[model samples]
Target: MSGQATVLVVDDEIRSLESLKRVLSEEFEVICAKDAGEARRVLESEIVHAILCDQRMQHETGVDFLKHVREVWPDPVRMIISGYSDSEDIIAGINEAGIYQYIAKPWHPDKLLDSVRGAVQLFRLQKETETAGIDMKLTPERVKRVVTEKRGAAQQLFDFDRIVHAPDSPLRDVIELGRRAADFDISVLITGESGTGKELLARAIHYGSSRSAKAFVVENCGALPDELLESELFGCKKGAFTGAYQDRIGLFEVADGGTIFLDEIGETSPAFQVKLLRVLQESEIRPLGAQRVRKVDVRVVAATNRDLEAEVRAGRFRRDLYYRLAAFPLHMPALRERPMDIPLIARRVLDEVSKAYGRAVHGIAPDALSRMQCYDWPGNVRELQNEIQRMVVLADNGQLEDRDLSPRIRSSGAPITLRNGHGNGHHNGHGNGHSVGATLKTQIEALERLMITEALDRHGGNISRVAGELGLSRVGLRNKLGRYDLRKGVSRDG
Candidate 1:
């Protein structure tokens, strides 16, 4: 009856029951039951939105109890929590009990909370559709209209306009391309360095597409081993392997009508690439233990920082898989490549961090902003966000000053001052106004030469260190050094 969704936590162990309750009590009306009988009684008396049950119980297994619940009152979303070793029983229970999700042992509080939230959303969506007389018989147009109505808020939140960039920012072209890509149902490969907001762009594409109403799932492929990664994306049944206890739905299945963003796809092994290539090529996937393949209508949006084309040439990656994923490739410009956008991004990040931490910081000082734009952010947008957050925390006054910036960023680049006059500005502590009548290309070359020389001196002429600092390959750096005629004093050591 309360506004908050009610969740039933059923665990034979009192400690676990209490822990589950504690984790969810802040957001939901959490009710605890020691066993199946107590859970049944509570479910009959209260309106439960979701059920979190422990698989192993003293009297009856959680599966049996949930199966009974499905027969009697099946509206609540059901999830089972068990150790990795309970795969066989859990797999059988999945279909028989209509289990929505399986929580592995030692669940993270945040992840558990996210799962519960998703279940509650599903519950509410189901109820809404039923009440609106929207069923399987509805036409595609009708379904799209209703779903779009329900998901309008999310669409607005992730609209293409939400991506912050200056008018002349290099990212503008990429965003436009991404927006155009969103209109079609095609696989997208977003290539960029880490923290360059590849996932953010992926979200924008998904929300902008016709599949906005469905689930937009994400998985970091590099975080898990080949076996686990395969299981996570392609699903796995009980008895698939050692410790396989429950039937798990893959991210592909979950994002059936929407998009699945696979981050760090380049880190997958060649063997795994073959499997992924099959899924993309055929639009179907076979679970680890299942005999039949299931067709999926999910759009795949994969991202990586690695040069996958180079990897293919080096025989470290499959050329076939690379082609499949890069059907609509979009490259994200690194932070240094889009220096004009830094001031805007920094201001936005400052506001977000200040509000998140309840700080009184109002703005970044002009000098601090200039220094930020001058420094080459090797870590890209993610690094900029972290820097802003730190400055907001350490700031004493209303503004973030240059003193609050990290020492490396503060000392990395020469001071940059933009003037409204037609004459170009001076740099490198030089009084000669060589930039006054220099062409754009000449000015760019001058800046590059200065950066490379400074980096070489600061890094003690180490080629590798200077190359990394400037976001260039060793060979590319060497070529630049040769062009600038500065390789004479540089060390050859890698």
Candidate 2:
């Protein structure tokens, strides 16, 4: 790459280096280095956004040179152009060099062009993230914020685990455990409530594992019908079913050598469960009505909000399969259990949401935050995330205030249970009759209405989002808003 990027190609082969120069010259200022020593001189002279290095070199292995580059001058996205795809030494280079992409040689020009473009995109995003500050650490509150801004604004696909991975706090241990869990080729079962981040953990395991190089696919088991779910999970031969117009590779085959995440895995029916069990046990699957079984080396990582032990006891799940899937079980802590992490999590989530939405949400105000810590998150992190995303999207101003929080949280002045010295939990706060002289439910309801009204006003009366956390439909939410007669004069967008 020359001028703007000044790319450096390091290879002992003249033809390889020359061909690259020709392809890259029109787009970048091309610089050539025949060996490691020459590459060093080129690196010292220019700032490169991308590097295309050969796998073999006389003075040093391409991986060793890249490893050195990583320490001394870590610029540009690193790639290995190698013919030896099966070499252990080449694999060693992959990890050591921090290679962004690997191009198996005799390379095609189109693929090379695409790889460079992808590398450039990575470089630009890294630069912007550095300048814009995208630190990946999820305190409970931050995850709550992200739940609100799901997939967030700019349509940016971020490494969700990275959000929890970058922090230096006690949560780092949790993040590391998640990373290690991803490394296994066996089944992984993540258990957590609605918002506790089971899917987030699943994504982390996929990205931090060897499967990071392959497609990390996800499907909610409960989201579709039995036949649809089956079709989605396993590929079908043409005319296998009525809708099977063409032969399609199932997620198991599509995600070969990678991980296929089955979210809400417990939701699958008994018949569907049988198919899943066979896949796990045999590492092979026979498509519907097909006589032959196909072997798949895919990793299975499943998550559920429900307890499989209960499902097994109830005859809803297979006991043998339960044992197989829970080879490694990861329990994601609820947001309430990790209250100390809320402030940080909320800030990180808001930062990401603001950046994604192109808004200027500085952070959650401290006083508003203090009130947020008291309420129990029955729906867990997912609830918090949804609320935060709703508020961020609905927020009338840059600062997220107490009034901007969900009504359930803002109206949490009612009595709540606290642990006693005897280790029994009892109602501590007043006004709810769970305690003496408890507050009226009517009063709590009023506060709830007020909180919802304010969030709706801030969001320009967006019913879909206001109803999101409440688990109400848009039409139902609209009725509530109408009852409150929530209205606005000045536009939040302006």
Candidate 3:
């Protein structure tokens, strides 16, 4: 048998404690504690590497004891277990006790053993960091290395420079805002369509932030059930609920000294929103079944496709949480609104997809690019990426031709005139399905409407600024607005 580290297991029930001891005894030295008091006594004497404490006890809760442990004897990797999935207790343990993992009741022996072994490894790494003169319990460099290694080449490519955009692209302003926000430790909310690279911007913000060297964990609130999502974000203890067989480390804990990107924050239920509000307000988390909350220094960067202000007014979202998340807000413009960026982004995607698929694709044809720029990209950047990859995979010649693009893009509308070196490719001059060319007047009005809408979205519905940018008098702009039926398009508050 290997000379393994000592593990302290605390539980009020003798049967369960004995079962845990039996499962772990062969691998390591097992110390048993019947209650928090007993656990305290064991901890005082033993040089244990990890502690597995029960959340529910007669005298002291697991989180309460662990919080005390964090103060006096903080070296051991702390974990909690409980029968109930109480979110308040769970959040408390995360914020106060600094639990390593929260395991639910009726844990599988193998998984529990694996968790203890992992905790031992964490304890060793932490000790090494301390011995190497690092003051923090968790080494930022070490954590960064692990995250980078796990994420591989993809994460490395998400830095600020990778956010490709043309010089006049509206995304440039958003990117600049994000970079500036990264310098400060503040909550940032990125609002955009699903495929508009909100997560990409979030990653860039994280990597550019002061906390870049620590973990940058991500959680999708919309992807999981409320109970599961709560447990995932805050963590759950053993016996916290059925199927919670092992202690789990939450994204909040993993990103304690770094950032936690919460995607689709608007999709979370109102009840879950309240819990999230508590965390943002207190800057702490309580693991499921925990007795006290644990403090965390994690910066939050939330992203959503929904209009949270609308949600808040509809009573579907909590106002306080919305305000907390949007302390700094960044919006990504849609792909259709930034047509000039399409060619550049498409070329970038082509290069990436070519390498990924081992294709010998050179670049995109001008005609194809012109076609792409004409189509209104409802799916935004994500759709474009998929289209580019599809073209790369099917390209017969060195370059992707017009025929290589999807039928949706090819059959959409008349190709826009390319500003760069691309030649003027004329469509049948039909508007939307009309084989007849659009009258010169119809064409001008369409172009005018497009420009006005872009300005409104960019300037947050500032009519005066829109008029100035379009080189029109306020009355002229107002006349155009009336002609185009655009008066209701922007709110007066902007």
Candidate 4:
């Protein structure tokens, strides 16, 4: 203790106390205590630099004992070790007892030693700061300003503007709704096809909210079994099940003051839905093999590609859970549904993939882009990204051309051609068609007009329905109707 930092290890179990001591004895002066009472006596006599206390004991909880220690001996860095990962207790220990770190049970000796060493270093830094009068130089206003600046940076990173889409994208309405919902403390359910960026929207909502300073955790609920999912979201005590050797903090607890994005939420079974519903309704979770329930303040943003309403009607999903999760629902349109956005998305992907692969490809040819827009991307944005990555890897020139596209995309539609005004070639091998001398812009306008006319006729001249089907706003569709001179037969009724 004369030269090395002194650490105090407290546990009721004799073997655990000895194990912790043995791990630290080589690097520091280690002291052991059987319980809180003995620990208080040691603290009163020894110059302890750090204290590692077991959370559970025969008489009192580690949190309660540490809270008392904080009042009496406030200098030493405090840490809690336990076989149970109860988030509520951990949070309480951190807030009330000023805990520095949490060591899970069955922790590796190297990790344990590292944690203790870090704690010792922190203790020394604090002592040096006090000795140099550095703590006195910091004011509350300075601290508040630093915190505010950090939060502002996070908000900017996850702002709604960060979401990639064209001006006329169908995602505009959904993004507007999400921006509004972010200011409120309510659950949101985002519905979309896979790879439509549901998790990205969820993140924007979280960081744009008041809870931006806190954690934002994500979990794909469809990837795990019922038991494992439960343990992941609600935590578990050591020995709760096979291989649960250490207490682990759950995502909900980790995101206590922030948001949790549960992707593919519709894949959860009815049994798991019941448990999740209970947690949502009560704002609490009970760790597996634990008798106590912990309260959490977490905002949930769930996403799924499935039609949950149909699932409920078919008795595959719970109606209550559906309603709970859909407090504010949003839908992300598929890539094919918003064809006008293809060029922008494709260019963005091209730039990203080119840089990642160290390629010189900086642009997509107009012909290749037109073909991509014609093909319906059933796999959505993710599929488009993969296609771009593949093309970048195989590209032979500075630009991505039609031949660089995958066979499926290249053959998806006819190549857009610019014929000479003198009709050097026929359009589509037909003799001297109207499009023979058409410019690229003229051909694009003709295609747009044809699509709008077909959509209007298909929806029985209902302007609103046609607009929605064409992924356009009502005003935009009206403008298109007027441009194509097809408004004469269109009805204003939605």
- Best candidate (score: lDDT): 1
Cα lDDT tens digits for candidate 2, 1-494? 11134467889999989998898876665688999899876665444557889988888888988998888766467888888875776677767888878888888888888888777556534433332245563433453344335424322343544544213234556666776776667688888778777777777677667656545677789999887787677755546678865444466654656678888889888888888888887777665544445566778888888989999999999898789889988777666665545555666678778888888787665435545555666776567667778778767777887778777676664323222211122333433323233234432333444456455555665656666755788676665544433333123431
Against the true structure, candidate 3 reaches a TM-score of 0.62
What lDDT does the true structure give each of the candidates? 0.79, 0.66, 0.76, 0.78
Per-candidate TM-scores read: 0.60, 0.52, 0.62, 0.62
- Span of 10 residues, lowest total lDDT, candidate 4: 418-427
Off by over 4 Å in 3: 1-156, 416-494
lDDT of 1 at 51: 96
Q: For residues 397-472, write the lDDT of model 4, one tens digit per residue.
A: 7877778888877555554444321223234555543343334554565466556655766788998788777789
Per-residue lDDT of model 1, residues 1-494, tens digit only:
11356689999898888889999998887889999999987765455669999999999998899999988777788999987556677787777998889998899999999999888767655544553356653432454466568568767878889998866678999999999999998889999999999999999999999888776778899999998888888777656777656555567765667788999999999889989988988888777876656667889999999999999999999998888889999999998787767767887788889999999998766557656766778999999999999899889989999899998886674343433312244544665434332344434554565577668877889999999988999999987776554665498675
Better of 2 and 3 by lDDT: 3
Error of model 2, residue 215, in angstroms? 1.6
Winner on lDDT between 2 and 4 is 4
After superposition, the stretches of candidate 2 with alpha carbons farther than 4 Å from their true spots are 1-174, 393-397, 414-494
For model 4, how many clashes?
0
Compared with the true structure, the alpha-carbon lDDT of candidate 3 equals 0.76
